[model samples]
Target: MNGMKIQITAELLDGLVLAILKQDDYYGYALTQRVQSVIDISESTMYPVLRRLKKNGDLTTYDQPFQGRNRRYYQLTAAGEQRLQEILRLWEQYKDNLDQIFYQRGEQQ
Candidate 1:
């Protein structure tokens, strides 16, 4: 089966990251892996997003000892959760609008 490749916008990335963190905290590498399971994204691409979210106060990070090294884990802050909800709402509306147009066109075929 083939899939249509779509661009992952900043809002989409931010929403996905927040949703993942809502389930549980994750380190940079682990978060990238989780996201990769669903969409294709490079490590370099993910790092800047994580940094921006943290800088925006939407996410918080803590270092934990693991395998004799400190791994930074990202958790969703209250603001992050709120932002996720807002993004989700907007995404739903956008998807609905597109679906209406696409589904109507498909039905005409």
Candidate 2:
């Protein structure tokens, strides 16, 4: 699987970001790092997603002074929570469907 590229859709990206924020607020860099730890994505790809989520009212931001500089943190809004729940439900259904196909096919073979 080395060097294999996995394409992550925008819906999944949004869900991942929202899920992370659900745990705690994070600055842009930290958020991008956290997401990259799980999925291969560049900061350039992440910022626009953050902007879209914020624009959609699914997230909010705040600036906290850190070492004389303000660190902007992204937090999940109530709407974000709802959206996360919807995403999770859909993910579960999708996973289950794939699992059934994969496992059942193997068992039949």
Model 1 misplaced regions, further than 4 Å: 105-109
lDDT of every model, 2 decimals: 0.94, 0.95
Candidate 1: Cα lDDT at 63: 100
Pairs that collide, model 1? none
Give the per-residue lDDT digits (tens) of candidate 2, residues 1-109. 2688878889999999999999999999999999998999999999999999999999999999999999999999999999999999999988888898978843565
Clash tally, candidates in order: 0, 0
| Model 1 worst lDDT run, 10 consecutive residues | 100-109
Give a tens-digit lDDT track for model 1, residues 19-80: 99999999999999999998888999999999999999999999999999999999999999
TM-score of each: 0.92, 0.91
